[model samples]
Target: MLPLSDASVLVRRGDVPSTVLDDDLVMLDPLTGQYFSLNPVAAALWARLERPVPVGTLIAGLLEAYDGDPAIIAGETRAALTRLVDLGLLLVQPEQAE
Candidate 1:
């Protein structure tokens, strides 16, 4: 995954009600009352968002989890992240000054 600006992601502890089912992450957002099922790839991405992980880090973690080619994973992750961002599931945090 390409590096995403920190200002583009927002996730909170209470935003999702998540459970692991058959090694998959199923999450429900109470605020939006939306239920989501995450595939292994998506689950890995979601897990990383528990904290403010860089998009590149998230992609690397997924590569480790699935042992797949980085290019394919990166493309897929970018699309998924975009969708999540558009869905308002994430709150963008402003980039911290170096």
Candidate 2:
């Protein structure tokens, strides 16, 4: 598994197709014939993932759009994105080390 940080770029898996109904996202991985759903917050993140997005961008957006502690938002987003990556619903582009 890859470590996802603020600099990591996240994008929806190209081979996977997704459907959105309200705030929920249903992802179907055709390769494995598996499907998964994301809740409202995760769904919103998924929508933004139509293109590659930096993890920091996501954290900043959530912080400004919602009322929550910054630390908590970052942690939760990282965890959720990790799971999505593991499930093959999302892809991660690791940040280049300086």
Q: How good is model 2 by TM-score?
A: 0.85
Q: Rate the local accuracy (lDDT) of all candidates.
A: 0.70, 0.84
Clash pairs, model 1 backbone: 10-91
* Most accurate candidate by lDDT: 2
TM-score computed on alpha carbons, candidate 1: 0.73
> Residues 1-98, candidate 1, lDDT per residue (tens digit)?
33455244445344567898997888887877888788876876777787775666666677787767888877888788877776667545665666
Model 2: lDDT equals: 0.84
Q: Give the poorly placed runs of model 1, Cα more than 4 Å off.
A: 1-13
Question: Lowest summed-lDDT stretch of 10 residues in model 1?
Answer: 1-10
